[model samples]
Target: MILVPGLWLWRDPWLQWAAGCAGAIRAAGSQPVWFGYSRRVAWTAFLRPTGGTAAELVRRFLALYDRVRARHGPPSVIAHSFGTYLVTRALSDFEGARLRALILFGSIVSETFDWGTIVARGQVTPARMRNEVGAHAAIVRLAAALRRFGYPYGESGVTGFQLDELSRSVNVRYTGPWLADSALARYCRGVWVPLLRPTHPPRRSVLTLRSRELSRT
Candidate 1:
């Protein structure tokens, strides 16, 4: 399994989490390969993804994937945050059986990602976000933002925007928060009163990037 970390992190927890997950996979009779990437990134990049940024990340992961295959044969992958997104893009065009399972945790990917194309080559993205974070009001707020941008967001069993394809081998599980559908998620949700909402409208220029994102399929 390859352990990928989220934005702005490439070490420590990524390595530590890999150790723990590797232990588990070993216990189950598997060899795990933890792939690591950029250790740092400008925080502002999240708000404004540079053109080709995603493609570049995918290219890096593809290079690592090739190295992993040559050294350890096809192995299952486990990625978190941006790592998951990177892996997804890396394998989307892959046509070989050099991969086994794909387990994503806290994946920050759009729902419309081409899962079907990748699954045909044999790997699946987990669609268990909403269930796992339903109780965390903070996550709900985040998911809402994801939804506003047409990204996959909310509810257990929710496959927000992936292609209309299914994989029997796919394993989707909600392992935390589970707040999107919870009463607490609803109650503590921010900006309940419209009057309490931001008084000043955001600058029109600020909406340009977001508008482009939403306008895309």
Candidate 2:
């Protein structure tokens, strides 16, 4: 699985998450190959430049698509938050970069369908997290348009952009609004990580991008 973390965090974060997930898969004796990417840009990367539109962001993302595909060799991707935009854009431009599945955690996809309006709505209240919002809504819409025909977006909307197109080869899993840090740490440190190692004698394992069960949080 190609693991991509949210912005500001190093690529290792997703590996950490995957490590936690590894325990679940290992219980079934599934050999998991976790992939990582440092290209995890900040949420703002999708936003418009002084004169650019969302299209510009897509163009740039497409330009970098090859590097990612070459590294992971068409992986089952897991993207959280803003990384969803990056994954969507990559898949839109390169059909051969087929994936097995896509798991989006706590996605900010709601903003992608109508970013301008979402921004405006937030402006009314002077929110603190405003700076994190970006051109993701626009990018997601563009990707959705390219990948499929009729997917729609809205508050509490079940249909998402680009997901159906992906479903042809990649199963799309959505686990949004995930319980915040407390839940995450519990899943990570408490459960996933512990189950991966030899239990009789506790030992510290060398953590790598390779498939291995990891602790969470």
Candidate 3:
């Protein structure tokens, strides 16, 4: 699975939402790998700074995630809204890029996104990393006010993911208008087909220390 779409989506009627999340990950049998954008990306080239085009879509999403992990071993991403900042900068600036699960929606990255060095270098696993927040997402609040002119973007889909530690990574808030095609088919059949189910099971541990009375500010 790997959908990754967002931006003008070449208008013409809109609401593809990664082809309705690639038809709900092909009716939950998986095999998606969508990833478009060879052209037609205008919202003024998604708010300027297009010289590299977000590092050439993070080098074509790490060359289609290493040619689909050299034939299906580690592909599971959902991404939206500038493809969730190009899949969090290709899993935080690449290095043996791996992913067995991740889902974001209408995100614009930068809520101080280190994710503790992408969860201490395992690529993805804070219980498989989901983030679907949408507190009245006005284009992620104009990409958090264009991040004060430097423009990397923020608001974490509007006030989620301010991680400091102990992040289970499942933000999941919603209200409306996150490009709603019935809220992306009810979050693609109730939260990304049961979290990219191959019999689910990803509740990892070990990164502690975020208790400040369960903080959120």
**Per-residue CA lDDT of candidate 3, range 1-217, in tens?**
8777767644521355566667767876667877777445534446763457667777888998999888766888877777788788777778679788888877888777888787788888877777878743787888779878887878787677877556845676865344546467666766677776655553433343355435653
**Residue 66 CA displacement from its true place in model 2, Å:** 7.1
Which tens-of-lDDT digit does each residue in 1-217 have in candidate 1? 4555555433465343455555545554445565554444422323434436555666666777778767655555656555555565566556653454454545555655666666555553333112112122343346437566654433212343343444332434444332222332232122111211223443556589888888995
> In every candidate, how many clashes are there?
14, 9, 0
User: Which residue runs does candidate 1 get wrong by more than 4 Å?
Assistant: 8-11, 27-29, 42-53, 93-98, 121-171, 176-217
Root-mean-square deviation (CA) per prediction: 20.4, 14.5, 17.3
* Winning model by TM-score: 1
TM-score of each: 0.55, 0.39, 0.30
Kindly list the per-residue Cα lDDT of model 2 for residues 63-176, writing each as its tens digit: 444454465343344455445555554554345444434455434454244333322433211111111222233433443343243332221112333222312222123332
Model 1: lDDT to the true structure:
0.46
Query: Considering every candidate listed, which one attains the maximal lDDT?
Result: 3
Question: Which of candidates 2 and 3 reaches a greater TM-score?
Answer: 2
User: Any idea what lDDT model 3 has?
Assistant: 0.72
Q: Per-residue lDDT for 197 in model 1?
A: 20
Model 1: what TM-score? Answer: 0.55
> Worst lDDT window (10 residues) for model 3?
204-213
Q: lDDT of each model, Cα atoms only?
A: 0.46, 0.39, 0.72
Worst 10 residues of 2 by lDDT: 124-133
